[model samples]
Target: MFGLILDVTARIHYALRGLMPTNVLLDALHTRRGLKWGVPAMLLAVPYALAAVFCTSQVEAGGSGWFNLLALIFAWNALKFLVAGPLTLMRLLWVLGREANARRRAARALLGEGFGPELVEEPVLTSRRA
Candidate 1:
């Protein structure tokens, strides 16, 4: 029952350990917190990503290529941290939220002993990543 949810979160935390920030991993198990951190992270990331891409295009075009090397590296890492990291957190949170909701509903139905409620035999598998 509720243990399943905790189990899934633990697995995710274990797998993602040291690969991302602790806050992002913690947020991945809850929707509201995930969105609160993820949205701002995503918003802050766009500029860096855009800057990286634009700089890359400029370098590829052979215009001031060498001069933009430092900027390119900084922007690339920033995009990876600010955009990709938080995006991963948010997606994992979404999947976990859906599975949790399904489990909760199933538990409620079982407790109420209501008929016509479909039983969840196992935790739902989702394509989301941590």
Candidate 2:
């Protein structure tokens, strides 16, 4: 039972690590970097949400099918800003708050103590222009 729980937890942690933005996650974990990138992203989202609301009002007045499609796009953008974006950030914080395998791996890498399989470098691309 204990082993099963550990396995599940490790998998969950691994998934969370993959979801995380590497630099941001490492900065947040190692130092106490707060809202450096997150604040800018949220600030940008605000105007988009407001624009969506304005478009919604305009679309209602028009009562045209084509405009409805535009309204749908506006609504999607608004929902991403007002709902999904914040929820994602909240989830990230929640995941980061706990002790996980990701944190261990990060710490190990930072301390130059890695002991897994070596990473392979990406191949260089050469462009030929005629």
Candidate 3:
């Protein structure tokens, strides 16, 4: 039945989630603080890409057919890293903007309770003009 197939697929998916190293790394990278490392993580794609190229070259030179699988895996990982970088950077910027907006709202709330409208409406002059 379709229900049995769905149950089996779900179980396999969960099983693989625990076994995959990339999933663990991705979980860590999804955190707010971890977002800052995304740009730097793109550098990791270079080694993976190089490995893929090497594997492909070996296969072309009459190496084992299994090298093609390795090449495919490396290429996939390289693509993931390359894409994660910009996506993470964009997420980081969004998080920072949200935090800034929250801070500004809090400041306005506090200022409105204790200060006059003039103070809230006008910019505070740090220096007096003669």
Candidate maximizing TM-score: 3
lDDT of 2: 0.54
Clashing pairs in 3: none
Model 1: what TM-score?
Answer: 0.34
Q: Estimate each model's TM-score.
A: 0.34, 0.36, 0.82
lDDT of 1 by residue, 20-125 (tens): 5534544563454454555445565566667777877787788785638856665755665566455666686777799789788867756465433444454333
TM-score of candidate 2 relative to the true fold: 0.36
| Candidates 1 and 2 compared by lDDT, better number | 1
Which tens-of-lDDT digit does each residue in 34-90 have in candidate 3?
Answer: 999998988989999999999999999999999999999999989988888999999
For model 1, give the 10-residue run with minimal summed lDDT: 119-128
Model 3, residue 55: C-alpha shift (Å): 0.9
Taken over the whole model, the C-alpha lDDT of each candidate is 0.62, 0.54, 0.85
**Candidate 3 — which residues are off by over 4 angstroms?**
115-130
Between the candidate structures 1 and 3, which one is better when assessed by TM-score?
A: 3
- Model 2: per-residue lDDT, tens digit, 1-130? 9999999999998877666553244345333344334434545456656666666777778755666666666666545444433555665676677646566655565445333333212222333352
| Alpha-carbon RMSD to native, per candidate | 14.6, 16.2, 7.4
RMSD (Cα, Å) of candidate 3? Answer: 7.4
